[model samples]
Target: MPFTIGESVLFFGIISLTTIVIRFLPFILFPENKKTPGYIAYLGRVLPYTIIGMLVIYCLKDISFTASPFGLPELISAAVIIVLHLWKNHTFLSIGAGTIMYMLLVQFIF
Candidate 1:
């Protein structure tokens, strides 16, 4: 499907306006000089940990106890990520190494 110049302009104008509004909405609603609400502040403080926990659970949501390799690849990868994170406290290294290890394990080992 193709849009005419007018239609394209109108569509893009609405998209740009929406993007700008969403990007600035936080700043507009929560000014730097004003105190943020307790719930919002608490969410900012605690959401990262909860999000990480959710992601870890999501990653391990699939497992077959009776299958070949028996979830070893994922378990090993998780352990590697944990060790790397504790060893260096580096986010990129831990995730990168763990991802590479998991890719190799699934492709070659299992």
Candidate 2:
């Protein structure tokens, strides 16, 4: 199905407005002059670790220790991520390298 010109304009207009509102909503909610609420501040401090824990659990939930690979790929990838993060203190580098390593292991090695 092809969108008519007016429909396309409306669609793009809605997307643009949504993007702008999302980008500015944080500043509008948490102004520079006002102190952040204690709970929000606490969440900001704690959510990263919580989310990482959740992701780790989710990622490893399906592993079968009795299987052929025996979770070596995940273990090695996690080790690489830990070492890279510790050595360089860079989250993106560690996560990206770990993901690439896992893919390569799954495709070629394991």
Candidate 3:
């Protein structure tokens, strides 16, 4: 595709519009002043864990224990995630730190 003004604007406009709707839809559905339904609140609480579980499963799916790295980087990073999460109890911090550690290990050591 040509990087022309009209084409770029059309593409970005669609993306921006979609982003706005996705962001605003939550607020529209669950107003801050109003109480959320029990089911929705329950789902909100469990969704993070569900996503994390899915990511862990996906990450481990392609691992080859017999290969060179032998999954050491992944295992060590997972340990970091577990330890950080347990010690600090901050999900984002744990995930970010673990990701950085994994990247460093893979790039430098394994």
Give the Cα-based TM-score of candidate 3 against the true structure.
Answer: 0.56
Candidate with top lDDT is 2
How should the candidates be ordered by TM-score, best one leading?
3, 1, 2
Quote model 2's TM-score. Answer: 0.54
Clashes of each: 0, 0, 0
Number of the top TM-score candidate: 3
lDDT of 1: 0.92
Residue 20 miss distance in model 3 (angstroms): 1.9
* Model 1 / residue 84 / CA error / Å: 1.2
Query: In model 1, what lDDT does residue 5 have?
Result: 92
Tens digit of per-residue lDDT, candidate 2, span 58-96: 979988899889999999999999999999999899989
Q: What TM-score against the true fold does each predicted structure earn?
A: 0.55, 0.54, 0.56
- Against the unseen true structure, what C-alpha lDDT does each candidate score? 0.92, 0.93, 0.92
Model 3 residue 101 CA deviation in Å: 4.6
Query: Which candidate order results from sorting by lDDT in descending order?
Result: 2, 3, 1
> Taking the tens digit of each residue's C-alpha lDDT, what string does model 3 give over 24-72?
9978999989999999999989999899889878979877899888889
